[model samples]
Target chain A: MKRIFKIYTPFINAGMQETATYRVNWVFYILGSVLGCFVSYFIWHAVFLSGSGETMNGFSLPQMIVYIFLIFLTSTMIGSDAAWAVGEEVRDGSIAMRLIKPVSYNATFLFQELGNKLLTEMFLVVPLIAGLEIVRTVIVGRVEFSVVNLLIYLCSCVLAYLINFFFNICFGFLAFVIKYLWGANMMKNCIVGFLSGAIIPLSFLPETLGRIFMLLPFASLNYTPVMIYMGVYQGTELLYYIGLQVFWALFFFGLSKLLWVVSVRRLSVQGG
Target chain B: MKHIRRLFRIHRIFVVQELKRMMEYKGDFIVGVIGFLMVQCSNLLFLWIIFNNIPNLLGWSLNEVVFIYGFSLIPKGIDHLFFDNLWAIGHFTVRKGDFDKYLTRPVNTLVHVLFEKLQIDALGELIMGIALVCVSLPQLQIEWSVFKVLLGIAAVFFATFIFTGIKIITASVAFWKKRSGNIIYMVYMFNDFAKYPVTIYNEVIKNLITYIIPFAFTAYFPALYLLTGENPLYNVGMTVLMSLALMSLGVFVWHRGIRAYESAGS
Candidate 1:
């Protein structure tokens, strides 16, 4: 284990260094997120103000604002473009370089992604969320924060990242067959964006559709963690949500492993 | 006149070459078209869901909002089809020093770079836009006239100029920054605001979109005029003016950027 750790440490460090070099890009990325948050916030605010209701779709005005903010935060925390990167490597056959290396490709990719996400969460997401929390507190008063909930939320976030990573890897493997994965990537983004409640709250969806989406792995990515943070699920239900997240993460990881094996074998047979 | 004709001939040849290259990967083209169609479909679904919950957003009905959304796509699609290569400037050409090739070309560098590639994927957006407009036409109940048709064509033409102008200006930042893809992306993303009625937003956002970014000229104002047949002269006039101003500004920036260009070493 120590030897394996030593092997991956360089990759993690290199990943962090590479991300730091793109400071301007990161600034614009955060700006885009802030702008997106504002768009959603203002849309919801307009809807609530114009409509004759204290609550629409089971959320009060303040709750809705906080919910949108949390949605953006959760999305930033869990989202991964590893699939696109992996897909590009696979398409160009540079993935062969990694294959010849002593380290496992999956582990290397995971560590690199971890390095990138850690820096982003530290420098971009954390500060943004902190500022947003202050704004939320000012507008909506204190949020209910408990040590227990925080712990569970953190666990769920980890599981959510794993699920997102594996889910993306599955799509990345499509590069084995498709000459261009841009369309597939966009399709995956649209489906996942909708199903994961990144675009709208799951509660706002129809009952049948919402329940179906809950059963899918995408929900575990964003909705589950946000719901836990909001204290919407507690006790046995909370445990169930966490269990589901774990299950999806493991499920996707196994599936991605299988797909990767098959794809590598196909590539080899094709003289790739 | 001779120079203009030569430019058109060169543009046509470049477009043909681009089309040939795109056709070489027919499966990729099909997938790209389907992918974009799915994106538009999902957006429509979101709008449908919103309208289902609330019959109207602000004072605009579902059809009106959809009309505006659909109308916005035409100019965007046209710009994408013709000038999408501007994205390569911010993304790679300048950053990787490939921009040196454009400088070596004898023809106008901006035109040469722009006409170098045609994005066929935008055909999806164009088709979808036309489909949406047709679907909403009867519901809008606008009186059809030759003058109205001409006006609509003019509005879309000017809107295309606006989209191209913004892209060129944003991409020109590559001269100084090495890579300005993120800034370009952020600016393009702001166009999402133009898909809906400006009244849905607060005063500050409204002003920002209207005067600062002038995205309101791209879709909302023109759609409002077409649907209500009110303020046709003012709205369309402003769109034309904005388009010309933005295009000139884009040219000015391109000239400035070219002067500042220090080619990345091979």
Candidate 2:
């Protein structure tokens, strides 16, 4: 464990330094996201006002508001764009330098992501969540989140992050073939944003469509974590969703490992 | 007249150069168009899902909402198609000292920058907008006449300038800051607010879109005028007036930024 820790520390430090250099990006990213949140808020508020039901899709107006904000918070914590980073290294032929190093390229990024998130969460993300919680409290008339759910929510977030990171790492492997992944990246973001219920809850979608999406692992990324936080799933049901997250995380991990070996072999053969 | 003709001739030359360059990246272009199409499709899916839960939003039917959404895209896509290179100026041109090349050119600098690239990927947005407007047309309650048609066309044409103007003003900030893509992104994204019924929002946001950024004049106001025939002078006229004001402001800022441009120091 000590040796493992030592191996990852430098990459983590490098990631934090890289992120620190782009402090301005963090601000504008949050601003754009907050604007998206407000747009969702007003649209949903309008929907509630027009509808006769007190609850639609099993969420009250207050719960729906919390759901929207929590989606933003959780997705920010868990979402990965490792594909873009990996694709860039490949494009500039810097992957060869990375390969020569003793470190595991994919594993190092996890530590780097840790470093990136540590800085972001400690400074930007935590403060934003606190501010949102205050807004949520003002809107809902009380601070009502269960403390137990928060603990479990954190655990689920770990698995969700791993799942997302592996998925994007797989996309990064595509850089071996595609050369430019900009369009593919855009498509991935939209599809994931929709499927993961970051834009809207899956329950609000058509029942069959929602069910089909759940059959994939995207819902586990954002939806499952928020639902756990809201205490919508309990006991065995909660365990079931968390187990599903583990399954997807492992599946993507194996797939990415297979791709890494194949791609690296191809790389050496072509380089010679 | 001669100067304008010369500018057009130069613009044509640059466009041909860009088209030749585009042949090398045909696959990327196709993928970009498909990517945009998917985004629009998913957005419409989101809209559909919302309407599934509620009968109407802010007393406006889904078809009416769709009309406004589609109308907003026309101007946005037009601006995206022609002025995408503005993004590079905001993003890295000033930061990397590439702005020096534009200044040294003999042609009008602002015109030169704009004529440098044409992004064909926005064809997806343009086509989707026209498709949505047509799909929603039969259900809308608008009374169409030759005069109204002409007014609508003119409103959309001028509304395109609103997007271009906002992009220019924000992008020109790069001259001083070395990069202003985020500023442009922040301001340009306000157009999303106008894609829906502006009245559905809080008073503050409604006023923000209408007066502060004036993005509402690009879509909701013009759509509202056509749908309900309330006041063309207020809807269509304000759009034209705002476009004129914004463009003059845009050009003034670009010139000011030109004077301020210090190439990024090594």
Candidate 3:
């Protein structure tokens, strides 16, 4: 047990170091996220206007605005392009060093990815969210905040992050089979973009599609948490959604572990 | 004249090689194309949902928006298929030190870099875009004139030029900043806004899009010319002229940006 801790400590320390190094780039990310949110804001504002005076699918103009702002924040917070890591390392012959590490590469990758992601969200996404509120006040008036709702939203966001991390790691493991994993990852992005209700609200979706999507892991990433925050799903249903996120996270993490086991074995034997 | 002819020939050869390479992984290629088409289909699907709920959005009917979506793809798809390498320019040239090799080459660096890889996978998006225009034709209420048809095609090309130019400019920013690839993220954040009709936006925004960014010409202005019988600025000719001017301006900016290039990793 002490031996394991000794190995893991250095890996965790390295992740902390990388976070510190990349911390300066967080400003660009904040600006980019803010710009992205502004685009979504314009799109939703136009959409709401066309829906006549009536609020389509129970989303008031304010609710729609808030939902889109959160969607931008959540995707920026959780989304990772880690799928390309394995392919690049393998092709470039850097996987050898990873294999020789005292700690498990998968564990290092997971912990490091989480550390980097947390820093990105804190420094970048938080500022953008704050900026959005400031811009909103100037453009459309004041925003109402609820402490209870914020706590629930944060919980859902954590669950969503784990789900995103698991699925993206699964995509990375595909490098064992495919030479270039970009196409596979791009396909994943498209699915997440559409089904997650990031681009369009799930409430605006047809009843059947909305219900089906809400059950999926993709929805947990951006849609469900944002929806819950905007009060789209209430009470018991919100709890159910959060529970499903937990189930999906555990399920995907397990699958990823299995895939990692097979992939590493293949890598070792095939001399990847 | 002879050198120009030779350059064109080399470009054709490069494109053919790329096509052959794409053909090697026929199954993966097909899957990729299908997946891209599905994503494009979802864009249409979103429009369908909106039209079903509200019937029209800021004077754009389901068919008109469909037409705009379809034609907009022409420029975007062409850029993707022909100039996909340009999208990676910032990373490849600056961060990866790949630009060092490009500068050493005798021929024009821009031409070679722009055509390095062709995403034939985007052919799916291109076909869908054309099919969309065809599908909307019968459903479309407005009469199609020969002049309008010419203008439409011109506008699509112009939009492609603008899109490619934007990518080039942003990608070139890698010269000054590490991981300038983030600029693509920023561009995507803004570019997707062009998908909707600009009429829905307030005057300030509409003017910003029209004059500053020229995103309005990409789909909105040309789309308005198609949908409404009367053009905002008289005839389609004027709109086409403006689009050409924007495309030229984009090319000019790209050229200026290229000249400002300082290779990474001194």
Candidate 4:
């Protein structure tokens, strides 16, 4: 493990440098996300205001706003362009270079992604959340935050990140056979955007659909952590949610490993 | 007249070449279409889910909202189909110093660049948009008349110009920034706000969409004029005026950008 860390640390540093080089781009990305959150907040605010009741599916206007805010935070941590990077490399026949490396390709990629994620969390997510918290306090008053819930939310967020990474890598492996993954990437984004509750809360979905989404791994992506932070699930239910996240993380990781093997074999057969 | 005819001929040739190239990668083409369709379907599904819970959003029924959503796509699809190469300006061409090629070309640089590539995926959006409009037309209970048909066509035509104009202005920012894709993307995200009734939003958002960015002229205003048949002249007039204003601004910016252009590599 120490040796692996030693090998990957430089790559992570390189990734951090690359991210720093595009600091202006990150500014625009964060700005766009903030604008998106405002738009969503206003839309839901209108809906709640239009209705007779202040709550929709047990989400008050402020809670919904907070939920959107949390979704953006978790999304920044979990969302990685690793799939697109991998897809490009595979399409261009550059995966062979990585395959020839002494280090495991997945480990190098994961470490680099982790480095980028760490930078983004610090520079983008943390500051944005702080700003939003200030706004929330000014507008909606005090928000409930417990140490136990925060700890569990953090753990669930880590699991969500892993699940997302493995899912992206799985899609990246498809580039071995499919020359263009742009379409597949778009479709995957749409599916994940809806099923993962990034665009809308899963609870707002029809009951059967919401239940189905809960069963799927995608629900853990943004929904589970945000819900946990909201204290929607507690006690044994919270434990079960955490367990489900772990199960998905392990499942996707194994599936991606199997896919990598098959894809590498295919590449070798094709003289890649 | 002669220059316009020549430009049209060149555009046709470029489009034909793009189509041939797209056909070479049939799988990619099909997948692109499917991907766009999936995105459109998901958006419609979102609307369905929302409407299932609420009977109306600001007095707009499900069918009415769907009509607006569908109408919004026509202009967006047209812009995507033809002007997608503008994205390359912000993303690659300016950054890589490839804008020099457009300057050297014999044809009008803007025309040549705009027609350089066609996004076939937009055909999927076009099909879906028309299908949605058709499915909702009967339910909308609006009397089909020759004038209304002409008005709708005009609305779509002007809306496409508005979309293209915005894209051009955004892409032209590459002259100053060298890489302005993110800015372009951020600005483009405002189009999402235009998909619903403008009345649903607060005064600030409404004015922002109407006067500042003017996306409401692309969808909501036209749909309002078409559906309710109230203030038809005002809505359609604003659409036309906005289209002309935006297009002129786009051309003006493009010229300024060309003058400001310094190739990337020294």
When 1 and 4 are scored with DockQ, the better candidate is: 4
Q: Model 3, A11: alpha-carbon shift in Å? A: 4.3
Q: Show where candidate 3 strays beyond 4 Å.
A: A1-36, A90-93, A131-143, A231-238, A268-272, B176-179, B229-266
Model 4: per-residue Cα lDDT over B44-97, one tens digit each? 886787777676776788899889989988999999998999889988899999
Q: Which lDDT tens digits does candidate 3 get at residues A1-272?
A: 88776667666677667878755445555665676566656655766777776477887776677777788778877776556776677657788888876676667776677667665667665665576567656656666655577678888888887888778778887777876566666677888899899768887887998889888888888988887776667889878888899999998889888887888777743354
Residue B114 displacement in candidate 3 (angstroms)? 2.5
The DockQ scores of all candidates, in the order shown, are 0.58, 0.67, 0.41, 0.59
Candidate 3 lDDT, B1-266, residue by residue in tens: 99989888888989899879877887778777887787888777777776777757765677877887787777778888888886576545566766777778887776788867888778888888889988988887877789777777776776776777667667666655645666665664455556667766678867776666666666766777777756645334544565566556646665666677665655
Residues B138-250, candidate 2: write the lDDT tens digits: 99867889989999999999999999998899999998888988888888778888899998899999999999999999999999988888899999999999999999999
Better model by lDDT: candidate 2 vs candidate 4: 2
Note the residue pairs that clash in candidate 4. Answer: none
lDDT of 2 by residue, A166-229 (tens): 9999999898898559988988899999999987799987789888998688998999999998
lDDT accuracy of residue A239 in candidate 1: 84
The estimated TM-scores of all candidates read 0.96, 0.96, 0.87, 0.96
Clashing residue pairs found in predicted model 2: none
| Clash number for candidate 3 | 0
Report i-RMS for every model: 1.6, 1.4, 2.8, 1.6
> Could you give the fnat of all candidates in order?
0.36, 0.57, 0.39, 0.48
* Candidate no. 1 TM-score: 0.96
